[model samples]
Target: MATPAHLNRVALRGRGARSNATGRFETYRSESFDDGWTEADEAARPLTTIIQPMKSRTIIARNDSPDIGFNASINPYRGCEHGCIYCYARPAHAYLGLSPGLDFESRLFFKPEAGRLLERELSKPGYKPQVIHIGGDTDPYQPQEKSLRVTRAVIETLARFSHPFTIITKSALITRDLDVLGPLGKAGLVRAAVSVTTLDRKLARSMEPRAATPERRIDAIRQLAAAGVPVTVMFAPSIPSLNDHEMEAVLQRAAEAGATSAGYVALRLPLEIGDLFQHWLRTDHPDRAKRVMSLVRQMRGGAVNNSEWGQRMTGEGPVAEVMNQRFLIARRKSGLDAPSQRMDVGSFKVPARAGDQLTLF
Candidate 1:
């Protein structure tokens, strides 16, 4: 448990801790320094989590952003417990009147009514079925999911309504819902993608705190495939000068684990994320911090990130092109370039509401 030079009192990371850096939004959007009780005292402070219930009116969210493929999505949680330092969704916490730093992960909000809301929306007249993307912002399968079961309830709703949906998660908890996903897969109403940032256990722990181990993720992929679910592997947000080198290896391992399709997104640092990530880089890998930022800027068009639709996911430069080319080549060679399995939209059928026909099918 080492501390940063400036944050000598604060722990930079825990075992598998990825977000030890101070929250940028905590400055009240300003900067101030205090030299209280040396570094030892700061490291002694403990980390705790507080879960709150969110009363959400709707479960289905419409997205017009051309950046993502899906139009609608459902996230059962407001914040994530997986404290991945590079989570692009971190800044969203600011909208909740909270800091996007540590608060984004430690302070979580769960939507208890997600399942009912989803069912109600599905019962609406003329409601067309689309592949509702789950885990859009915060991971619906995060640790809290085990106890709250909000995500499970949403999936159950989709299954009952014959709604097509997709899942994106880094947790192995999804395997627990094989009962739900298995049927959806057979009906062609569900697909899933698991994210593996790095195959290296140590790095994986450091980069994504609280997520299942890399081995567990691969095992989850195997389990999903065994259950006949269409599984894809995602090497999301490849960090420059760090896990980027492991792209080929990650693809190979995932393919071996029964993943038929794969995709990736270059690291994205919008708003407060840039500051939080830069601080982590300097603190953990100080020697390579400067070099990493340099490469990131080169790929991001002289900025730490690019929010442009076309350039945000994949940057526009020689370096970015190289990464993309490498990925495509690896995918092709690994037989991951096969046509992606599309969710069966035609199978979507509206189900009866509470008072409607008992046989909604």
Candidate 2:
């Protein structure tokens, strides 16, 4: 297991018995193999590279989850580059025949025609307006967004139709579209939430390698607030023995930055994500890895995770309770308990096609 030079900052490397697979990388379990084993008997595989392409159809996706807020959502991209070790979205990449590890960050997908598809969907005869969520599955403003501008185009379409929507992201790039978002938000048709995991730069870098810095995200919240856009600060995926201690601090900072609401969720490792998260812990924070996993198991009811609808978001146990208490206290002290106001959909009006003729009075 050779460590990639770029990853030396984390001081970790992959080490496991390999198989003789040719097309894709495969992992095998090894339990006390015979001593003096040599590399000749190991299997070799080719590394997969990034496959960038555009999704052609169906821009809007519906959500039926009981705990989530929005019913309709849009994802401008498929995979995220902000390699957050605890990200549950990592498992989604496995469906693309890619590793949930490094491949999740390198390989990416974009919806180049998102704006056109959205316009068509909204223009349907029976189409109804709801609070459409952006970046529900992946960050709409990830690094590639600077060049692709898919998210920007989608926002433009929503604005043209006077539609309401919400956005969640850790990127400061959302500020780039304030010209479009600010007015809609002032009209009570749009809101944004910025995710701030930790104030510690080193921890942030290791946990979410490509996300905007904590300070920059704070600035984004402030900027949005100044523009009259409602901003909610999210301390999401509260990793138990890792970033939990900073929950209160994060709330305070968000409040100081003019955020009006706050929320959090315990770290979730579902499906293939469980293995990837464990591997990350053992690699980066070997010393605290055991303690962290132990606490996580306690909250997860003696396992790595619990996916039941009620228990999945916040987990269950004393540790989870303490975290909830801390979050509540901070939120209250910061005056961040304002009830979320529903965005107005009654005012929605479908725009006429560019070539459509207007009737004279």
RMSD in angstroms, all models? 3.2, 5.1
Which pairs in model 1 have colliding backbones? 9-42
User: Which candidate wins on lDDT?
Assistant: 1
Model 1 spans > 4 angstroms off = 1-43, 353-361
Which segments of model 2 are wrong by more than 4 Å?
Answer: 1-51, 359-361
How close is every model to the real structure, measured as TM-score? 0.91, 0.88
lDDT of 2: 0.81
Q: How accurate locally is residue 326 in candidate 2, as Cα lDDT from 0 to 100?
A: 87
Candidate with best TM-score: 1
RMSD of 2: 5.1
Candidate 2 structure, TM-score to reference: 0.88
